[model samples]
Target: QQQVKQSPQSLIVQKGGISIINCAYENTAFDYFPWYQQFPGKGPALLIAIRPDVSEKKEGRFTISFNKSAKQFSLHIMDSQPGDSATYFCAAPYNQGGKLIFGQGTELSVKP
Candidate 1:
């Protein structure tokens, strides 16, 4: 199993709203999980992540809720804001090559 698929292609959330995006994977062997955030014309940056050994992980305004049994994971952005508008991506590596298999892309728009 080595595939991760994400949805919503795009999202729009109002300021102070909660923005949620879901992802599914096929690889059970994957041990590392990471969610990346990117701005226009920029490379993806690590936002948050969780390991298979853990159920969930949170960092600052970002959180990653993982389900090992369901082979699913999600990213949650708390108190959405206009500055939070950007593309989010979920990814996993095949075998620690520093290469990540990413979701198609999700363009998030946070309105003021």
Candidate 2:
């Protein structure tokens, strides 16, 4: 149950629109849920994250919603801009704390 399934493999949003991406997991051993944003040639950067204790977390235009009972979480991007176009990944570090189980990446494209 280490897999974190994500949806809307690809999305196209108009500039200034809201972009939402979702993910679900089955593992309960995970402690930290982090959403990462990756550009074409750079490593994924931490966009936002939440703990099981927190129901939701927000950073600027990026927000992450967590459902501990459902083993799910989602990322919301408000005022999506063309610069926000990138691949996003939802991940949780295993109990051992070295490896990360990731959801299928969501590719978002913000059209101008």
Candidate 3:
């Protein structure tokens, strides 16, 4: 089955701490890996994504780690703040970008 599985259904972090979410998949058809962040009343937006051949990517306080051999990827938020509280999801596009499969979201609460 084409599926993406994510862990830590909910997380609580203190301000300036690190928040991490992990995801694993079995399908090889997923050529791209992306992480999205969504607020309570907003749509999930692309937060950070990694290229197929890249091992890791870092952008500001966000980072995506890809392990091709293990079929896993993770998102890390460094120095996380209260404003970073949101539901996060990892996704992969299949069917040649025609469709996307998402993981069970991780609801993050950044405590002040």
Candidate 4:
């Protein structure tokens, strides 16, 4: 089974600083990469996404940088805040059924 390897199981950042998470995959068949954020009691929500055709994508304070050659991608959180504290996951869609294969997940904490 294809998998996404995520780094830094947890991260701590200042309220106004930046938080970064990285992931790498082995399957070249995967074309879509999406980042999800989950709060304590809520289901995960899509934060941002990028395709192999695009090298980078940004929305509000979230950004996704993709490197097709290396089969890797990363998420950057700008101006990290307490509200941004949550578990983030990176995932790729399965080629056949379109199911998502997710990484282990990274817990982020923004300290004031």
Candidate 5:
């Protein structure tokens, strides 16, 4: 029931291209920013994340860019492939309420 606005709602990319998804939040209570990847008929899995202490972090072909001042973050997938196609959701965990607020989710399609 928290408000975390996610943009584009969906995305399409070709193999070996880059895929990017963005999300913004109004509540500054969020300390941890994480992106979850979900496939059809499966649960969401942790993909990449960043903390307020850093501006960006990269893992493999995945990267997370965080802006503390803007209360925003993004997930970038480099060299995207058909296997990378899935739904991505950005989350912000509120410590006080112990609830993880998730964005609307972005559906990514990587075509070969």
Candidate 6:
């Protein structure tokens, strides 16, 4: 399997609340998991990431909770804010070239 599926296409969360999203993949060969954050009209940048070797990873207000056995992973945004509104994509490299296969894309809106 060469696909990663994500849900909630869009989400709205109040400031200081937690924003959550979920994703799953079928390919077991995939390694080097990564999550990207993008603002309108901008290229996605690496937000946070975790490999199969770890169950969780966190950075600032962002966190990635992964479940290797279930072949799923999720992103959790703590202390959500209006500035946090943006699109997020979960991805993985299919090979060494750094080519990434991404999730459908989730638009998160943190209300003030």
Report the C-alpha lDDT of model 2 over 20-106, residue by residue, as the tens digit.
999988874656889999999999998888976779999999999988778778999999999999999998776675688888999
- Which 10-residue window of candidate 2 scores lowest in summed lDDT? 92-101
| 21-92: candidate 1 lDDT, tens digit per residue | 999888744567788889989999888889877787888888889887788889999999899999999987
Better of 1 and 4 by lDDT: 4
Model 4: per-residue Cα lDDT over 6-93, one tens digit each: 9889999999999999999888455899999999999999899998778999999999999988988999999999999999999988
- Cα miss at 3, model 2 (Å)? 0.7
Error of 1 at 112 (Å): 0.4
TM-score of 5: 0.93
**Model 5 residue 32 lDDT score:** 88
Off by over 4 Å in 6: none
Sorting all predicted structures by TM-score, with the top scorer first, yields 4, 3, 5, 2, 6, 1
Clashing pairs in 3: none
Poorly placed runs, candidate 1 (over 4 Å): 96-98
32 Cα displacement, candidate 6 (Å)? 2.0
Clashing residue pairs for model 6: none
> Relative to the unseen true structure, what is the C-alpha lDDT of residue 29 in candidate 1, on a scale of 0 to 100?
45
Query: Per-candidate TM vs. native?
Result: 0.91, 0.93, 0.95, 0.95, 0.93, 0.92
- Which residues of candidate 2, in runs, are more than 4 Å off? none
lDDT of 5 by residue, 16-37 (tens): 9999898998784757888999
What do the candidate models score in CA lDDT, each in turn? 0.85, 0.89, 0.92, 0.92, 0.89, 0.88
lDDT (0-100) at residue 19 of candidate 2? 96
